[model samples]
Target: MTSTAKTPLPPAACATALDPTAEPFYLQVLQALDAAGVPYVVGGAFALAGLTGVERPTKDLDLFVRRADFDRLDAVLGDAGLRSELTFPHWLGKVYKGAFFIDFIFASANGLNPVDDGWFERAGRATILGHPVRTMSAEDMLWSKAFIMERERYDGADVAHVLRGCGAALDWHHLMDRAGPHWRVLLSHLVLFGYVYPDERDRIPAWVMHELLRKLHDEMLAPPPASGRIQGTLLSREQYLADLRHGAGDARLKPAGTMSAEEIAAWTAAIGEPHEK
Candidate 1:
């Protein structure tokens, strides 16, 4: 069960823009979630804005709802005359209201991390769409954003800004645990963050740096994971299909996640690339 502290928004005010004068589509969805008692933590641009005060134009609202509550959200949105779909059963769903959409996220696209009860405990409250809503924690957001290094969309800068803006407020130890086996990704971002803002280098904890460096040193001396599969394809499905196809006969080749061959082929085709011959 999630928590809500803010009072309900008036139907008329639900449509109000972020300016609170004009109703926005995203708010309407938020209002519906409130009515249905669905526990959600707002993320993406809105959460980023609330957490870091760096606002950017967003195409849609991102709401992280627990997997169990998704059906509840689906029914609530339907009753509110909205259309929705579970685009990826493993990780995401979408609620459509006219031209606007809400990305209902349950887990990371890479299938590595999930939004569990711990996320709710760490969420911070903020006023979004004229209603108070839980915002994702900096640590959770950083973990979620770390793997979004697709060809067209890279969120490294966003990660750096969160590091810069949140500073000591971010939970370094939790983030390190969240990164887990993927600690190298975290180290790369930290290195870039130091490069992006030289003055803020000290903002990141010294032990975190030492720990990551230690992991790197240990990795350099150790053999790679037993699986001969080239996992780099996990970084970007579209960009790495060639690597996967070329190694099709190699026993070491394996998909990094749950993405099915059909799904991968469809995804590649959507980007206008021909299916592997």
Candidate 2:
């Protein structure tokens, strides 16, 4: 709802596939971002398409950049005639060049995964719309998509596909650290990945499962939390408003994350707005 409005391209045009040609504006934006020397990795459907080899039309390109680079990114876009604005200062921004636009996302919709320098260090190369670009690693993509379980859109299948397509190459130890306090979300996706691709269950390393299982076993034995905080908001900010309104602790709040109440409110209010993350 807060984008620098443009005569946006239809979903059928300017797709983010490896060989798209319906729209040329996306390429221009990507070229500008690259020329600026600011670190970013392709994300959203294109990144998944790169990892899974399933091409599909995307409304906009997703460029994952760090918060520290927002100002520089905005300035660079402006110089190139691509109007940019911080759509949600907490996590997302948008750059518009007439009919085509791209998202400059710095954090997850749930305010969980914040883009960091390590992402570029671990990035894999890909060709999007014929432009050679870096992409989010399979582990980072899986980690970020694991929590996208809204009623309208769920990325569980994406997570499963990443595991099936590139699970063997994933650095499980690094992934474990990425999940950190959210290891259970990672484990759930892994369990389902094995279920979804029973023939490829061997793709998962044995020790990873053992470690997660031991953690689960220990937690199940421990006493339940007396506070009973409803952290489901961390997975879908729009779907869990009722619980938060009833005084449940929003995991997006501090001590848990860097998002503030005002930021959470802005992000929450932007739900259902067209062309959102």
Winner by TM-score? 2
Tell me how many residue pairs clash in candidate 2. 0
Q: For model 2, what is the error of residue 221's alpha carbon versus the real structure, in angstroms, after optimal superposition?
A: 1.6
In the range 106-180, model 1's lDDT, one tens digit per residue, is 887645577899889999887764589888888888888887778777889878878877757777878888887
**Could you tell me which 10 consecutive residues in candidate 2 have the lowest summed lDDT?**
5-14
Q: Which stretches of candidate 1 lie over 4 Å from their true place?
A: 1-24, 248-269, 272-277
Any residue pairs clashing in model 2, and if so which?
A: none
Worst 10 residues of 1 by lDDT: 8-17
Cα lDDT, model 1, residue 150:
81
Colliding pairs, model 1: 15-23, 15-24, 16-22, 16-23, 17-22
lDDT by candidate, in order shown: 0.72, 0.80
